[model samples]
Target: MKALILVGGFGTRLRPLTLSVPKPLVDFANKPMILHQIEALKDVGVTEVVLAINYQPEVKASHSQISILQLRLCLLKKASFYFLQVMLNFLKEFETKLGIKITCSQETEPLGTAGPLALARDQLIDGSGDPFFVLNSDVISEYPFEELIQFHKSHGGEGTIMVTKVDEPSKYGVVVMEEETGKVERFVEKPKMFVGNKINAGIYLLNPSVLDRIQLRPTSIEKEVFPQIAADQRLFAMVLPGFWMDIGQPRDYITGLRLYLTSLRKKSPSKLSTGSHIVGNVLVHESAVIGEGCLLGPDVAIGPGCVVECGVRLSRCTVMRGVRIKKHACISNSIIGWHSTVGQWARVENMTILGEDVHVCDEIYSNGGVVLPHKEIKSSILKPEIVM
Candidate 1:
């Protein structure tokens, strides 16, 4: 089987991190975010994976056709090139590592959720009539790809969406389906009133014929294509069994990390860290150095080349590659970006995010501060704010 991941252009929701690295390349639990999905797809016998990325057109003064938004996107031209280069290199490495044929499907114009499928029609359609998987890049879950495919095949529908129960159905696109038949009756996108507890989990298995419903333009699958499929009685849904989260923002990313660690502990306890200094579930990379007397636990992931000094405490956080936490520093509920430094006795908590190469001065305290890249924080941030 084949798969396509909708890796939209410039992940603005995950800024600072996305500014430095592409969203797909951003580290989640010491591994690139897209790697998780790719690995899952590989496990379910997916041979080729297509990354549907948006291509920004160059700015031309003579062209009156360009909109203000397109002009603004042109400003990121250099950065976009860099992102593509990095992504290609990463894909090359993973292709060999995972033994999968991974390729890119670049869209010259902005194509919304469903349009990418139409744009990459040639790559997906191999004349086998086999269903291909479609996934949103930001979503993290214990991917039940095998079961999802089985369910989709059993329903004999053109498309099958994986749905999960959520508390606030109004905040998301709710899927209303027959409990017995799993046939989708309708989709309610952010309805003011309660429709159902189940919401789209951003994963789908669709036949090649489903691509015919989509046009090669800026079109939403949720708003346009799925409704038609449902009306034709060719759309179905399969309930997801485990945890699911769209880690597209900082807060949700941290929350997703905790959920991931908990699931990891149950699935593979041997991978988790264990020692006198450890409190709960913790993941320390083999290259990371943990000094004596440091207390780390309750959902913490220290990436490769990290150094946690003596007396440092960490909980419910992700310390990315090459970060250093000096002696007596305390960090919780936060993300320390790549190669950042937290000085001695410093305290960072409550979703404090330090961008790449950021340095927090000794004896400093920060609460819910989103520090940008290559910055130095000398003063304390008492409240939640962005430090650009």
Candidate 2:
């Protein structure tokens, strides 16, 4: 079956990082966010994928089979143009990483969730009236797609939404389903008071018939489309039995990385931890390096190609790929992004997020603030820089 991935959002919440790359391309557990979704869809026998893109057409082009092979890399000595050439080259080199046929549907204007379906309606549907899968690109899940499809077929419902129970019903649209028939009774979008625990999990197995109802305009499936269909008693709910994380906010994004890293450690224990001085639950990638006499762990993750200098101490922190932590530095409860460097004696704590290429100079203190990508923090005193 075919799948549609929505990738056109502005991603205003994940600023600085999103300023350079799209939200779907953001790194989680050393891999692009959307790649996880793509891999999951492929596991469920999805053959084709359509990317709804606007900001970065190059990302879509680089992943396509044709562009992956044919795109050429050109290098020049000029500093400004050299980086451009490198990007041009990689886009050419890594095509066809996954053999699925990828087609990107670009929107000239901002098209809402249902609007993209209307735009790609012709490509997504055939005369046979097959059910196509649609998933939000920003979420990470191990939900059983095959079982969800089976549940949809058995019920013979017009539309089946994959739902998961959440503790905070106020944060999501709570779905009330019939206990016996598995039919969707109704949905209330983020009710001020709690109504039910089941919330929409951002996964849907949609029927082709439902596409006929969505008009060619800016519309949301949750706010505009699904509720109307529920009045006709055609929508159904299928409970999922796996982990689901929506990487929308900063805290959830960091937690999602922890969830992914922790899962990897469980599957292959030998793959995560190695060397002495590192203790407790931790995930260290094969390419990462932990210096001698360094203390780490108790819920920590060192990503690929990271280097921890001698006498460094880290706890409950996630260090991304290409990071370099100098000697005697102490880091706790923080996420240091790719290629960042922490100078000796630097102290990072209290949920600090250091973006790509960030340099925290010696004896610096950062707390409760996000450092934007490519920024340098060298002051000895703590400063609260609020990102607008």
Candidate 3:
């Protein structure tokens, strides 16, 4: 089987992190974010994975915005080459790392979600009428793909969408599936009233023929394609049994990290750190140097080459690779990105997200701060703010 992974658009929700790299390339645990989805696809007899991307926008330039148009044209000329180079490197690394044949299907103009399928028509079409997998790149989940395929095959539908139950259905695109037949009846995107608990999980097993219905224009699959298919009674829903997280934003990325680690601890306990005072469900990479007398845990991930000094306390934080935490520092609900330095007697807490190569001087205290890359923070931040 083949798969198409949607990786288009600038990830605006995850700024600074997405500013430096694409959302798919952002590190989740120790691996690039999209590797999880690619690995899952590889497990289910999938060989080639096509990345559907929008390299340029479709809008025609207006004379009133000539400067903006000029800037965009310049960026469009350069950005595609840079993106292709990064894609090449990522493809090479992932092929070696995960052993999958990855390829790209770039769109000259921005194609909305669901439009990419029609845009990549020649690449995805097969005469044998086989089904293909389509997934959004931002989701991180314990994808029970084998079971999903089995369910789709038995359901006898043109499409089968993977759905998962959410507590707050109003905030997401809720899927209303008939309990008996498993057929999708309706979709409520951010509904004001109580609709249903199940929401679209951003994964789909789509028949190749489904592309025949889509046009080569900006279109939303959720709003356009899905509703029509549901009305035709050819769309079905398969509720996933395990965990799912949409890690498109910074806060959810941390939450997804916690969920992933929690799941790993159940099936693979050896993957987590093993040492003194390691409080709960922690994953310290093998190369990380954890000092004695440190209290870590309740969902903490210390990446490779990290050095934690004695008497340090960490909880619900991701300390990325090459970070050095000096003595008596405390961190909670934060992310210290790659190669950052937190000094002695420092305290970082309350959802602070520090990008790569940041420095926290000794005795500094940062609370709910968003520090960008390569910055040196020297003062205390009691409230949430961005430190450029």
Candidate 4:
């Protein structure tokens, strides 16, 4: 089977962190966010995975017989291109490590959601008449891929979208489907009136024929193509069996972490950390060093090479790789980015997001502050704000 992930362009919703690292490469629960989808696909017998990326690195043409020094200077001048090059290299490594054929479908321009399918049509249709999976890069869930495939095949529809019930249907595109048959009747995008509670889960299994419905230009699969498919009675909806969250923004990302950890506890309690200082579900990488006299969790993930000193308290937060928390620091409901350092007696709470290499001085208090990369906080942030 094959899968296509719509990675889109720069993840502006997850700024500061996405500014430094590609959204797909950003660590979530000690692993890259896209790795979760890739691994899930691999487990379900997916052999080839295509990443539909909008941005293609534009490296200048190399002059023949150029010196190594000149190449270094060129790379230094094009730092963004260098960063993209590094990200691509990591994707190549993923191919080797996972033993899957990973291909990049680069777009010349921003081609909304549906156009990528038209562009990558050849790769998806291998003459087997098999359907391929399409997913948005930001969504995280249990990923019942095998079940989805079974349901899609049973329906024999052009496309089957996984739908999840949400409380606020007005905020999302609702999927109105037949209760018994699962045939999608219509798609109502943020309806002013009351509609169905089920909304698109950003995951779809579609037949190759569905690509014909899309043009080779900017098009929305949800807004444009889906309605046509539903009108033709060829679209179906499958109710998702587990938790789902669009972790594109920081707040949703944290909430998703909590849900993920809770799911993990239910499925594999042994994977969760258990100690006297551990409060609830906590995931600590083996390389992470947690000090004594510290209270951690009730939902927390400590990534690789992190150091937490004694007398520290952490709750409902993620400490990314290589972070250092000094003694007597209290952090809750926050995300401490990669290599950040929190000094002694610091207090960080309420969705505070510290970008890569950020530092908080001793006795500093931060509340709902989004600090950018490579910054130092000397004073307190009493309210929610972006510290650029």
Candidate 5:
């Protein structure tokens, strides 16, 4: 069946990384974040995908073109397209080389998730009148899409939402389902309290009729459309197996990378160590180097051209391209973005996330803090707080 992916959100919450690149293009597990979603959908027998993109359409177009080219090289080809780039050269190359057709649509203004569905309704629906899957580009789950589809079909549900257990239901669209039948009894938008732990995982198997509920203007599918359907008692819920991590925040983004790396290690022993001891779980791009006397982790990612100096300790840290960690620096549970430099003897700890080109001077200690992209932190210290 076909799938519709909402990738148009500006991703204001994930700044710096999303400043130049769309949120879907942000790297997670050594690949673009949206690639994981696309791959998952493909795993579930989805042959066609419709991307809804708004921010940085040109870059998104180029990235999709490159991905299509790579997929053709690897024989994982399927129908895909960036929402824009109907007139670009890359689209021509994509059409010629991949032998797959791509369609594009533009949103002149901001349209919420469901609004895009309304915009692309004619293109997405086929004559068969079948349901199509809808995905949020930023949510990454290794859940079995095929099984979720089965759950929807067997129960004759108008819509089936993939649900997962979370510690805080208040942060998401919480679902209250009947235990025996998996029927969605109620939909609560970030309720203050909850009796169950199940929450909306942002993955849906939606019937085309749901698209009619979405207005032509900006409207939240979660807040407006889904609740109305749940009230009608037609919504179904499915619990999925395997790991799922939303890459909306810096910490969750880093965690998603680590989780993907771990999954990779299980499939191949020679893969980078999900732990530092194994060569496989650690991914050091060809141009990156780990210096002597450094204790790298069970889960570490050293991006292209990065350098880890002597005596530096990094565990569960992701060092993006061209980052330089000087001698005697100690970093753990953090993510250091591209071209950022850590001063000698600097100490960063406890889930600190440093954006691109961030300079942590010598002896500066930042813990549980976030450093926005291209910012300067010189001769000073920051504590455990949100950096951006």
Candidate 6:
């Protein structure tokens, strides 16, 4: 089977970080965010992936034949495109490492959720007459792809919308399913009143024929297409067990990091950091350098090439690749992004998010501060603010 991932749009909710890089390329658990979805699909027999995007990179002015020799990504709507190139280039390595072929499609204009399926129709549908998966790049879950496939086969529906139970469904597109037949009845998108607790989990398995319901225009699969399928009595529902997280904004992103780490510890303890006195669920990459006397734990992930000096304390934090945490520093409930450095005796906590290449000087204290890439934090930040 094949899968399609929607990786378009400027990620405004995740600004600064997304300002420097595309949302799909952002690191979560030391891997690109979209790779998690790709890996999940691969485990369930997906052989190829289609990355549907709209962000276009332009060539530089001093462009020469040598420019062709090097892959350089320029600005996108005035934002950095270097991360865009990294995203495209990484597909080569992903194809080789994961044993799956990847294809990319760019949209000339903005197309809503269902339009991409129509745009990539030739690649999605063929004589094979099989169903394909559509995934939202933002949602992360312990994917039960096989079970969804089996359920769809038995239910014999044209499409299966994977749903998850959330405490408040009114904020999402609430899906009402027939309790016995598992057939979808209707959808209530951000309903004013209580409709149902089961919400669209942003994952779907649809037969290629369903693509015919969409047009080559801006169309939403939820607000426009899914209703038609439900009216035809062809859309089924599958409620997956375990955790599902929508890691869009900073707060949810940090929460998702903890969820991911805890889940990993349960499934495979070896993936997490080990050794005597390890505090909690931690994933310290093999190449990371941790000095003696550092206390790390209770949901901490040290990415590859990270350096932690002695007496540093990290809790409920994600330290990205090449981050340097000097001696006697403390971090909690925060994310230290790639190539950032925290000076000695600095204390960073309270949901702070430091972007790539940030530098926290000695004795500085930061709390709930969102520091942009390449900024230098020299003083104390006691309140939440954005430093650009």
Best by TM-score: 1
Q: Please provide, for model 5 over 1-388, each residue's C-alpha lDDT reduced to its tens digit, 9 standing for 90 to 100.
A: 7888777555667766655455666666565576667666666666567777652222223444667556453331111132133223333454454343335555756677677888888877886778888887778767578788788889886799888898887887678899889998887777876767888788999888888788778878877887788888888888866667877887787787777677766665464633333333677677777777677775778887888888888777788778899999988778787789999888888878777788888888887767787777774445676555
Summarize candidate 2's per-residue lDDT along 56-161 as a digit string, tens digits: 2222243355443234311111322333343334333323666666666756555688888888887788666779888888888675788988989988878889
Q: Write the per-residue lDDT of candidate 6 for residues 122-143, one digit (tens) a residue.
A: 8887668889999999998888
Once superposed on the true structure, which residue ranges of model 6 sit more than 4 Å away at CA? Answer: 55-75, 78-83
User: How much lDDT does each candidate structure score?
Assistant: 0.92, 0.75, 0.86, 0.91, 0.72, 0.86
TM accuracy, model 2: 0.84
The 10 consecutive residues of candidate 6 with the worst lDDT sum are 66-75
**For every model shown, what is its TM-score relative to the native structure?**
0.96, 0.84, 0.93, 0.93, 0.78, 0.92
Order of candidates by lDDT, top first? 1, 4, 6, 3, 2, 5
Cα shift from native, residue 205, model 5 (Å): 1.4
Tens digits of per-residue lDDT for model 1 on 1-388?
9999999889988877887899999999999999999999999999899999886777766558767877775778877888988998888998988999999898888788988999999999888889999999999999999899889989898999999998878888889999999999998889899878999889999999999888889998988999999999999999998899999998999889988988998899999999899998899999999999999988899999999999999999999999999999999999999999999999999988888999999999999999999999999999999999
Worst 10 residues of 5 by lDDT: 75-84
Work out candidate 2's RMSD over C-alphas: 7.8
* Model 4 per-residue lDDT tens digits across residues 1-388: 8999998667878888887888888899999999999999999988899988774434455598557777765654465455567678888988989999888787876688999999999889898888899999999999999999999989888999999999999998799999998999998889999879999999999998899899999898999999999999999999999899999999999999999999999999998999899999999999999898999989999999999999999999999999999999999999999999999999999999999999999999999999999999999999999998
Q: Which ten residues in a row have the lowest lDDT in candidate 4?
A: 53-62
Judged by lDDT against the true structure, how good is candidate 1?
Answer: 0.92
User: At residue 29, what lDDT does model 1 achieve?
Assistant: 93
Decreasing TM-score order of the candidates: 1, 3, 4, 6, 2, 5
lDDT of 2: 0.75
